[model samples]
Structure formats: C-alpha cells, structure tokens
Target: MSADIPATYTAARPAATAEVSRQAWLVWLTSERRAARLTVETYGRDLAGFLGFLTRHLGAEPTLADLARLTPADFRGWLAEAAADNLSNATRAKKLSAVKSFLRYVERDHGIAVAAIGLVATPRARKPLPRALTVIDARAIATEIGEVSDVAALQARDTALFTLLYGCGLRISEALSLDRGQAPLPGSDAPLRVMGKGGKTRIVPVLPLAREMMARWVALHWQPAGDAPLFLGARGKRLDAAIAQKSLRTFRRQNGLPEHATPHALRHSFATHLLAQGADLRAIQDLLGHASLSTTQRYTEVDTAQLMAVWRRSHPRA
Candidate 1:
C-alpha cells in the first residue's frame, strides 16, 4: 500500500499595525491600576502570541467576537498543544493569566466584551518542598572553601557567598547582583538591602559570621571606589550564576552532602532552621518576600516533620 500524501499547511500573516499594538501597550503601562512591570511585559507578549495565532490559524485579525466564540474546550486544546511542545506548567499558567488580563483590558479600554476568554482556567501545580542542607553539612561545605589555597581571594568570596545564602536566605541572583557602593557595612542590628523578584527590594539581617567574612574580604581586596561587582570572577568580571552552582556542587560532593545540595538549598535551610527555632510564620513570609501567606506555610510542613520526630522520641505511650 502507498503511504498517504502529507497535507501542506500554510500560515497566514496579519498586516502590520504597529500603531494599534503600541497604543494598547502604552495604555497598559500608564493605567491607574499600577501593575508590575514584569506583569505588563509578560501579558503584552502573551497577547501578541494569541493575536499571531489568530492570524496564522484563521487567516484574519481576531475580533472580539472571534475570541467570544472560543469554548473552554478550545482553550484546553491550545494548552495541551503548549504542554506537548514541552512548556512547563508555570509558563503555561503565566501565558493564560496574561491572556485573561488582556481580555479584561480590552473590555475596559475598548468596550469589547469577550466573555469566553475568561473560561480558560490555568493548570494547577503542586509547590515542591524546599530542599535544605543540614546545619552540620552547611558548616562542612564552608570548611572546604579554605582548601582552595591557590585562590585565596576566591576562598573568602565563596565563604561569604555561601554564608549569606544559608545565613540570610538570599537567592543566588540577589547576592551576586550586589554592588560595593550599596552600603559595604551592614550595621550589627540592621538588615541588608536586597533586590528581589520583579524589581522589589527587601531587607535581610546579616549573620555575624557572614558579616565578618564579608568585612575581611573587603578589607583585603577592598578598592576605595565603591562602584564594582561585590563578588568578582577570576578575570575581575562579575561572578556568573553557573560558577556559583558549580562551586556549591563541588563543595557538596567533597564534603559528602546529598546530591540535592544547591544554592537554593541554603535558602530552604535558613527558613527551616528559623521555623525550628520558633520564628513566626508571618515574619518568615516577610523575610522570604512571599506575596501570600500560603507560600510561607510550606515551611511549616518542614517544621511539622521535626515536631513528629521529637514527639516519637519523647512520648512515653509509644
């Protein structure tokens, strides 16, 4: 039997209308609602993709009626296609959220009601448990930094970096993005200013050891001009994220820690250890810069495990 001939598919391109798209984007930015820049950018991109899809698949610009005609089943089909193409649930949810927001914006700004767009529900994702290093393992990894004798400055930098990660629960990106000009010395009782996600900034207290390590490194390699990368690479460039991960992996393997040991694990350890020591959930939420209390509640699950272990050991009814 002869194989069936493949059908050719042709995508339609919409005529360029830069003016309309630009006006829409500008309105999104200047609107009184005060959305985050990242959110605006993300929604803009998602809406553009949907518009492109309409032109490509249906050979016409998408009218409000066109969007209104879509069923939840149709949206689910699109989401399935995205998943089949290897998109993560987080990415899919972001895109769907963007589409929903855009639909709302069109209704409010242009007086076009596309009710069907609201039917697309985002996929639910389970929040993974935070991975953390044990206190002994964290100290052990720090000790191995001293073994890198060939690069004494790097030893101090790595020690301080890891110390801040576990000590203050800083994301690796936040720690590396620090500049020398931004308050070299954090006061003994004060919190260090850290730039977090979506350009939001937060204050995190410094551990004495972390502070000492940072001060010593600064004094030895300190340049009077405060406008340089806080942590420099061997070539005097800003340290890259990959290098930080590689260093952590090497230290974990050398010190016999679990394979899951990562820079993020230090953050998890910081929260977990704090919860064990009776830190309030709300305070932990503030420290982590979580937008929702439910996000901070996950750490309590870590605390629960610890509580169960103590109960088993101390209870006489066992």
Candidate 2:
C-alpha cells in the first residue's frame, strides 16, 4: 500500500545549438502552423519534460547531435517515466505526439533527422464517446434556452445560436465564425457553406425553424451588414466562445438540465437524433464536416448504448 515514488530525473538543459532549434520550432508553431497559444505552451512543456528525462537517462546535456542519436528505447524510457507519474494514456499520448512533432520539425527544418524516433509506437488513447442530449432535451435547449436571458436581443440570440447548433451540427467555432452575409434567411432553401476544421468547407442544410430564428435575431442585430460578424457580443464586437458557453451553463443551471448540456452537446444531439431517425453515417459525416468517417462512427456506439439502456428499463427478461 505504499505510494509510488516520483522519478528522480531532471531535464537536461539543451546546448546552444539545440536551444536555437527549439526556439525556432516554437516560433514556427506560432506563426506558420498558427497553433493556439495554449498548444504552443503545452508542447513546450512536453518537450521540456522529455529533455528532462534524457538528462537523467543519458546523464548529460542533450545537443542536436544527441537528439539525432536518440533510440526507441530512449523514447520508451521517457514514456515509462510519464506512466510512473500516473498520467492517463491520453495525456501520455499527447506528450508523445508533442515530442514526435518536435522531432519531425527538427529533421525537416534543421536537418537533424531522428529516424529511430519513428520506430517508437504511439500510446493508444481511448476517446470517450460523445455525450448527446435526448430529443426532448435538445429541442428544449433550442426553444427555451432564451428564457434564462431577460434582454430580448440576448434571448433571441440564445435561441438562434442553439437552434443553429442543434440543426446544423456545427462546432461552436464554426458557428461563431459565420459572417453576416452567411446567415440563413427565413424562407431560403440555400444550404449553409461552413468553413470547417483544417480550412475545409462543407455545405449544411439549415432547418426552417433555425433559419426563422436566425432571421429574427439578425433583424435585431445592430449594424448587421456586409462582412460584419453574424453573432455580435454585447459591445457590438464578435461574440466570444466563452460568453456563449457561459450563457448555456447559466441556462442549464437554472433549468435543472444535466451538466453535460453544452453547445457542443447540442451538435452531438443533432447527429445522434439524425442517426436514430435512420440518417446515413457518411451523410452525417458530411453534415458535421468530419474529415474521417470513423470519427462519425462514435455516434453509433452512443446510439447502441442508449438502446441497451432502454432495453434494460423495459424488457421483461430483466
């Protein structure tokens, strides 16, 4: 029953040459890859942790030449240390990905190829199934979420935003990124052209109710014109994601909704509901703008689990 001891490792400081490469990679991540600030910082920490492990394992400061000489065993030792820390497989996997990304950058950009790093197997991280709202709950969020807001415009905004999310299966980022000109009109049959992840665009049909609500909100929007944001903040600027999430959190808290009731959950509900209604998995993938069909297949697991739950509740054999 003794607690696991911490690894007695210190990160080896990089030589000036290696340090220059690391800094340059970080800069490239920011400017060229357009990585988020948090991602850059997290990858920086992961790399630092790997270097720390190398310091202890190799008993010396790591140079660019040392990086080029790293073996699969060396990478495994670092992963072992992370495992010793009780980090989940997902976290370990992300750490490995960060190290691999750094090594790839070093090889490509600085001509320091660590070919042995490629021999190391990546950690298998089990992604949790997406949590979706029931059909009643999803519809309630779209129609009644506005009750939490007193201001007429805010109420209308909440209704329209949730409606669009549930109807169109958009990620919050995708929905928030919409320009005023892209807003679906009340009576139009035009499919929405959404710029999804990786700068890929997909067309999603808007629900008539969603369009009607969107048109209502647009009518009340201040300066709703060419190239302006589709959804405006209280200060007439583009609405922040945090603000939208907070609005939903407030609504859920007030309405006795489950903690899983989030804007993204509405998207999940959209997919799940469509699946229940016999929508094709590939078609759902296109609607959600998922690059992979496997990603869309997770909803099938969710649907199966729900059916099992219903069976448990209603079947006579139990």
Top candidate, metric lDDT = 2
Q: Write the per-residue lDDT of candidate 1 for residues 76-127, one digit (tens) a residue.
A: 7778877898988888888887777666655565455667666667787757
Q: Rate the local accuracy (lDDT) of all candidates.
A: 0.73, 0.88
TM-score of each: 0.58, 0.64
Candidate 1 yields a Cα-based lDDT of 0.73
Task: Name the Cα RMSD for model 2.
Answer: 11.7
Clash pairs, candidate 2, are 11-52
RMSD to native, candidate 1: 13.6
- Report the C-alpha lDDT of model 2 over 109-180, residue by residue, as the tens digit: 656689888799988888988999989889999999899888999998989999999999999999999989
